[model samples]
Target: MTLLIRFLRLILGTGVFVLVFGGVELTQPETSTRWAVLGGTLGVLLLLHVWSSPRRGTADDPHPARMSDGKPQSGRAKRQGARPSELAAALAACRSAFASVALFSGVLNVLMLAGSLYMLEVYDRVLPSRSVPTLIGLSVLVAILYAGQGVLDFIRGRILVRIGGALDEALGARVYSSVLKLPLKVGRNGDSMQPVRDLDSVRAFLSGTGPTALFDLPWLPLYLAIIFMFHVLLGLTALVGAIVLVLLTVYAERLTRKPVTSGTQAGIVRNGLTTTGNRNAEVIAALGMGGRMAKRWEEANRDYLAEQRSVSDIAGGFGAVSKVLRMLLQSAMLGVGAWLVIEQQATAGIIITASILSGRALAPVDLVIANWKGFLTARQGWQRLTKVLTVVPADAEPMAMPAPSRHIFMQGVSIAAPGTQRLLVQDASFALEAGHAVGIIGQSGSGKSTLVRALVGAWLPAAGRVRLDGADLDQWSPEDRGRFVGYLPQDVELFAGTVAENIARFEPDADPALVIAAAKTAGAHDLIVGFRDGYETQIGELGEAVSAGQRQRIALARALYRDPFLVVLDEPNSNLDAEGEQALFQAIVSVRQRGGIVALVAHRPSALGTVDFILAMNQGRVQAFGLKDEVLAKLFPRPQPAVAAMPRLRLATEEPAPPLGAAAAGE
Candidate 1:
């Protein structure tokens, strides 16, 4: 659409030239010749206008009112609108590319004006004999200049494209850098699924149209100014047309603001859906709830579709209105031009030139409108991205590194999510020597995981402090803190790569021997060897192809690879079967034996039976803390009695209460 509009602009410029000469001839004393020129020029102008007008039936305009069925029409697709730093970079590139073009273009416009004056002198018989050689030379020079312009324009376009590519890289880099430092909760924002959809939209604003707007910004204004110089009144009229068109573009942009916001919110919903689906996929499959899950997915998807329709409708309506306004302006200019000629305030030549220049002046504004919405949208995306960029990570600091110490201690630690009264963990205090194993156990939502997370400095306690050696955890630099602490969440995730690669995710140049040693210590080496490719075998998405036990082991291996002084494991043995659980328990003991402080959450008594100490929790508060056996005895003195079996009547009364499986399945 942008290219077509530009092409029309050039053709319109040519039409202006022809009309100027033709109208001048029409003012001559000879009626026969004057009528012929006027007729030919008017016919050509009419044909060109019709040819240039956008068609209603094309794919570009598949549905005048909407993009698809049940979707609302886009207000104006053209109005579809970048990052601030990115926009700045694009603007710089554009200015550089257009400098030479603008300089030469000005020269060419002057030459064109001179040539028109010379022709007028000849028509009025002021010049007795115009030299043909001089005219021919000027023609050749102008042709060559224009040809050079064509080449320059192509080069400029290519340069702009290259600049756009660079800008995209910069934008992506900025996002990645910010993401790496973001708090896990913030980085995990938009739900995991949202990144799949919203990231692409972000890229579009970055790579596709963001830089293009910056490129056209220079040319559009220059062209408009040149048209304005041809005739003051016509210029003003064209300027007004441009302004009105710009206003329409602004109105359309305003209309889309709400929809764009809705779209972003919808993206959040999709993220939630994705997280929900991922967290529940196994349950969905095992329970045969595929149809229900599909229905839920469908509902969320439909909501997204509806939001998209709303956005498109706003854009399409804007486009329709803009087109109508442009046409109206075009007609008005020509009609007023004719009137001026009839009143003798302007010559026929002047009238034709003014009309042509009017189109030229208004054309860039038209093109601007087409890209305005895209530019605006890009800006909004930038704003969203900028919000991410501005969020200071919890661990960002002034670069002073805390002194390394083997002592890990928490003093009156109390943690909670922001703006919430629900405590995640409260007034938890403990001290661990350089080498020790501590087991934390609680039912779900008892804050066992939160305690470990806080210990590792993943969660900032609202009150109290985590101290390493003598220095506070917040006093440590990010690198120092990361190097000292390692963590494993309940559910482990593995990227698509070799076992060795997954273990050394952050250490690109990690030794294969080191990776093997870590895997062995984490008890993942045997499972890795069982694969056909051994350690080189690729893991599928989230390591879904691997058993939960394997995933947990791999996570342990990753933590082992870090070789931190403190390892915080949230349910390291939760996914493991009996044998796998034994292996993980051994790994925990081995880490402590090797002088690493190990803190693991476990509910199963057997899994944590060997730990040095037990921290029993209930409802975010510590219930008991002492030697493992002592704490266990205090928490549960004896097992609760089993439910008494109902008496069974002889002769198999009630059909033996059905099989347990049958009864459960039936329920």
Candidate 2:
């Protein structure tokens, strides 16, 4: 399994990084003939990578599985809306670029031989023979090789930049949506930003010099082999040095990984706390808890700093060891080569070339040790983002569907808070026909909000079905359904846009007629037109500069703007005064006039007065459902029924629950 994954990674762009492995063959005194063979092998690997496709190693995958005979086998069909996983496929676009870069890296490694070869020729042939013509020829060829290497290096860096950008462009939206959908409890450290932040880390590592150093790593072996060709003793000396460096690299990772990981976790917590503090800055200031908050932040930051210090200590130790070993290894190789010369087993030229090769062999190892922290971060980031990448919907294109009518249905629907095991709502059922407004009254935690979320298809039901007419709610394309469904949450959230845009729900090309009608229906038209820029006046994210009542009125206008088939308003008039209450009642009547179904989660009588039906909830179940008057009378008696004949309905006497109404007495 490990080998398969490694091979897959190579095919996806790690190929360029592995090109350095064949570079040892370049330092030989031979001509361009030997270079061709090693280059040809990498070329073949590139070709194989280009032609390959990833396959799932399981039988139950929705994508077609492969048979033992190497032919395709049919599996269960995939969901109609979901597509096969394309995380790898999207990344594969960079493979060809990496292949080209690999070839360039290999050439550049070969060009490095120009320096050693120039010295070898001058020492062996130029000085003794006094050949000016040969000297000039070698100098020109060496210059050309160096120039080519420089040009290739520049091109390779530019290609890496483009690869990083392409990866972001290919997956940015998908990853962002995935992160948004993730519940807060799903985060590793309760920081919901991990998945998206992980992608950024991955991109940074790919585009940074870390990958370049890693690619050079494979060339160490080639360099070692060349030194061995010079003399057995020098080769063995360099080989031993390489082994020590590799072991040191492994040891450094082992020593520092835990501390670095702890530091990262601490950092995530610090950042999350900082964000929370900023978000509630007003509350903190009003409550005068600044000192306490600062102390808490300092404590979290101190833990992070301590962990980072431990990692730094380990890194410093490894770096010092790696530097000393590498320098000694070079000096030792020279001594070994010199002994061979004294014994008449090698030439003086062999001593210098062998020393240079040995030094180059250890350079990459030391470089990796230097950048080990960043490399470890990139690895962890990849692991953190892998699952989300696989699960993110690569294809969100909607299917063609006719518009939905106002008839709605819910049959035994159940719902739970995301990432929690207990259900917040269960066995709840209701139906609404056109030209009717339904009201849901419940205590604060009575699942009214959860039911509304399920109705809008934002939360999928765990047990039952929510449908529009005969079609399952999940079957409808979100884009198509969005046109017919307008939902206003209890908080009355708004984006940064003009008043008109907010009312039009930030649609770029909003219909003027619909926008005007909705604003008028919600009693916001006059208020907006009176603003400095009228409908064009800017609104803050939290509707800053606008009163809470104004924001609620604006949200109500947004919900009513599209003349949707279904409208859901959660506590629409919660922050409104008597006039705003009248406006909300009028808006509910407007939805009824348009032959639409409206579901209102409300606590105030003004918000519930216009509704034709009432559903009262307790805990997670529907305790009463009937005409508004019938449910109200059942919950609250005409005058307090006689002791023996009292109503048996469960009624919430807490804040926000509607008290007994006069309509209940006559009914």
Candidate 3:
């Protein structure tokens, strides 16, 4: 539509131009006027094409598609908002810069002909006439042409720099968001920014002469044709050399393909391990396990280096061969031209010119062989970015149902960690209504965290369904679901920001009153106030400045910021002291009393004090589930009366009833 509008606007302007300027021309010439006007118009249109080609850049589109929601989207949905046009727009300035470079390159290549032409003129014209004036004039003109080439070269380089910066600005944030959103359970490589580094490789190649070499390649035939114009024998010889070099380029690539692939894979693994290991520096040093870890990383690193070195060796050999072949080709062309001249078929001037042009013709091919590694890296990076960014989940529109009341129903919702086939939660089913407090009791690794993740739509269930308020959880858009659902993960991480900022979930313009309320509700208000700046106190990344208990409280406060209708807590009190635990217990019960469903994953019995019902999980399957007491009894079973002791007071003891209030309370 934009292009159509632009074309229409151009046509309208042209009509106006005809009305304004054609009054005399139309009357004067039936033959030449229109053509003359068209000639001028063609030049104008070409200028416009160069000037306004890309539509807009960061300056104009204050709202680019790749730059998503004001707040961090945190996951794959970060890529959801990115439209193809946005990426193109982000690169528009760079592409326009390249286009200009291409234009200058054309002029530069033409100027390259100045040296050849000057040589020809010296042998064919200046020397024959013995005209020093003509020689001086030619020298001045050649010097000007060389200077022009140098200027164009400098300008093109500046354009590429601008392009690189623009591309980085456009894509960096999206890449960061996508990385953060990626499921934690993804493969080892997932945690590393290999793709991001791949982006860097792409930008580095683009900023270099790789692009210029590509642009120069197509003009090879032009140089070769000029050689043919001089003498058929010289041209044919040069053409054969060119073909041989082309074949050699292909052969080198083929020979080096396996090593490149192996090296890249090994490098990703090595980098991933190194990044993961470094983040645990304290642990590695304290445990004294650095030696073993270093050995493992060294093995991977060694494989990568070996493969890369092998590729480099092969490529280096091919490069040397190309250089030698090029020199031989130049010498061979000169010899062929000399032979032609001896036969009185060519001139001395033609020999040198042909030799030079032949070298020029082979330059791009040599360049390809020389920079093959960077080219391959850029190619892989491009492919990786395309594959990753093209991925998008089905855009499910949010259900317009009444605000969720936290009636959750789970049926056979099996789950497996991302990038793994083993099931973490197998056919787990449960149902809970609003105003209910449910506890999930499980041993370590018994799928508590995995289940909640699936429940919150972070990772999909491998089978069956999870429903909220009678609608499939997948039916609701993440944004819509997020408005009412809150989750506190097992590993609580607070973003680097002020206490109030964390409590408000980093929502800009967060109401002070609401922030205070949330903090108070989670028992975090007093703790935050104890800091130097109260709500304004800045927290370090991952809340490293605070105690573990404080971090959990802050995270819990973040969860309750909006008074969500449903809350899922995966061992929320794991880092909390007894006081904090009591606060968490009260918060869960209070939320339940207010018609919010709370699913608390508990390991300690004390934390389950107020749960209305309990689900006991063992071996990824639900062992028992019911009223808290009923489930516990089934998990433990009834102790049988001893038959030998049945004779005396044992029978009376068996008949004796426990205290009614305490037994019924199930506390």
Best by TM-score: 2
Give TM per candidate. Answer: 0.72, 0.82, 0.80
Alpha-carbon local distance difference test for all models? 0.62, 0.74, 0.75
Question: What is the Cα root-mean-square deviation between model 1 and the actual structure?
Answer: 14.6
Give Cα distance to truth, residue 304, candidate 2, Å: 2.5
Per candidate, the number of residue pairs that clash is 30, 4, 1
The TM-score, computed over Cα atoms with residue i paired to residue i, of candidate 2 is: 0.82
In candidate 1, what are the lDDT values of residues 495-604, reduced to their tens digit?
A: 87777788886567889898898888877888889989998888877787788888888888888775778888887777888777777777777777767888888877
Ranking by lDDT: 3, 2, 1
Which ten-residue region of model 2 has the weakest summed lDDT?
55-64
* Angstrom error at residue 173, model 2: 0.5
Worst 10 residues of 3 by lDDT: 56-65
Task: Flag the better candidate by lDDT, 1 or 2.
Answer: 2
The sequence of per-residue lDDT tens digits that candidate 3 reaches over residues 536-606 is 98888778888889999989988888888889999998899988987898888778888998888998889
